[model samples]
Target: MTAISDRPQMLPEQFEEFARHLGRTVEGIRLEFINGKLGIKPVPDGDHGRIIQWLNRICIQARPELYVHDQGLKIQGYRGGFARPDGTLADADAFVGRGDWATTEDVLMVAAVTSFDSETDRRDRVEKPRAYAEASIPVYLLIDRDSAEVVVHSQPDGVRYESVRILPFGKAVHLPEPVGISLDTEPLKNWVR
Candidate 1:
């Protein structure tokens, strides 16, 4: 008698491999596997890269209990996918690797600087916030270049988030966890434009 078998489960490592392959094979399609689904978006612009760099500098200077990670760092979700935030703050020791670092229990925060389009904003402000909350990341920051504002999301409830605070440009937003530090907006303002 023939026996039934379960489908092959894809782990985070395998999913990353698939993403790398697709990134090379696909044309003009920038895809990232996030929250067990493929998050496909167009490449970001100069403003996006600037914002990411600015935040990375600030985070590193702050020297929170967590290490500050810039580009090339990916955060794996609770399911089988992953998301590469513009900046991530996690335990320094957890992020040691040659190419990509594995998500660890100490990864407390993830931030995405949005500059693509309305759809990208929606994904960063709404969808990704929910995904990070579900992943149990203590904090999620969304920097909107169009609006020149930062949205800090905390207190995860199920798949959603609470304690939503919006900090407009020219104001300092204090992040919760690892260390209590405020982010200056002067640099972002100067470069965003």
Candidate 2:
């Protein structure tokens, strides 16, 4: 019997087409492909939206040249993986004309805000860190609603991040170079479930 890991992954081009089709047909869900498995992201709740909004405000004030929002990226070092990071930090025009699945070349950071879903642990906590690291993205920010913590991952060496710092809500979190910004996470406490 063929194991799940042994199953063939859908090609990136094919996946993009399917995703576009789904985006047109579906209303509330988002799709992602990471580590050879398809992932479904449910519509975020109010607290989740607020967290992203707060982060965006900080990012815009700190670095107006950069942007952070839902942007699709091709990841995992040629694994046909595609991910729509809740917040993708990069140059303002980094994705201009790049189409749906933009290359990770200009990405400085990718943030994932955990949703109340069964896939959050695997998709945001595990697979995404690996995928973003493999793409050599400078930072991977995780705002974990489940635990009320901010996890900052940085310094990718092609396989994984060399530095990871976790701070509870209400503490300060510093993102490393390429995303040089200090976050006062106290407001984050108010956005958690």
Candidate 3:
């Protein structure tokens, strides 16, 4: 009989170090700090950019007294360092400075529009959620272009997130406390194709 693989997987810390080292050498590409590890993601496709633009427009239409970062915003965790969510919404005063905008306590929601490989999917689906949860950033949204789905996670429990909800295209997902906005994905479907 063939033996099944039983090798131990690398720890989060080890991955973190590798990611950090790679990030230092790499340029142009966007990298996120996940659980002390570095996660490099693609520059995003047209569909992803379209969705982000749609969300930004919606937020502007609503005008909820929140600060929205389409692509240039960076969110930093206590131990992990920094991550740039595709679209982040927080209190207007949460972001400060010109060249380098630092995240503050007023920040609440962080969202990433996913359109990359499996490793990036795992980072966005699992690692980033935990990182954002630990940072106590009320809401974390993951928009998957492949499946045309939006996953909203709220209620951070320790280093993980809870109350996870998956909303497919054509549906609307309402963000919970900290961010009381309803995100309609119906319009986003047009951008996917």
By lDDT, the best candidate is 2
| Model 1 pairs in collision | none
Report the Cα lDDT for candidate 2: 0.88
Model 3, poorest ten-residue lDDT window?
2-11
**Candidate 3 at residue 80, lDDT?**
38
Tell me the tens digit of each residue's lDDT in model 1 across 111-178. 78776565775578766887777777788888877788888888877577778988888898998764
TM-score of 2: 0.95
Descending-lDDT candidate ranking: 2, 3, 1
Better of 1 and 2 by TM-score: 2
Candidate 2 residue lDDT tens string, 1-193: 9787867477777788899999898999988888667788888899888888998889989999988857889885746689999989998889998887888999999988899889889888888898899999999999998999999999999989999999999999988898899999999988876
| Candidate 3 clash pair list | 16-37
Using all chains and alpha carbons, the TM-scores for the candidates as numbered come to 0.76, 0.95, 0.76
Compared with the true structure, all predictions reach lDDT values of 0.69, 0.88, 0.69
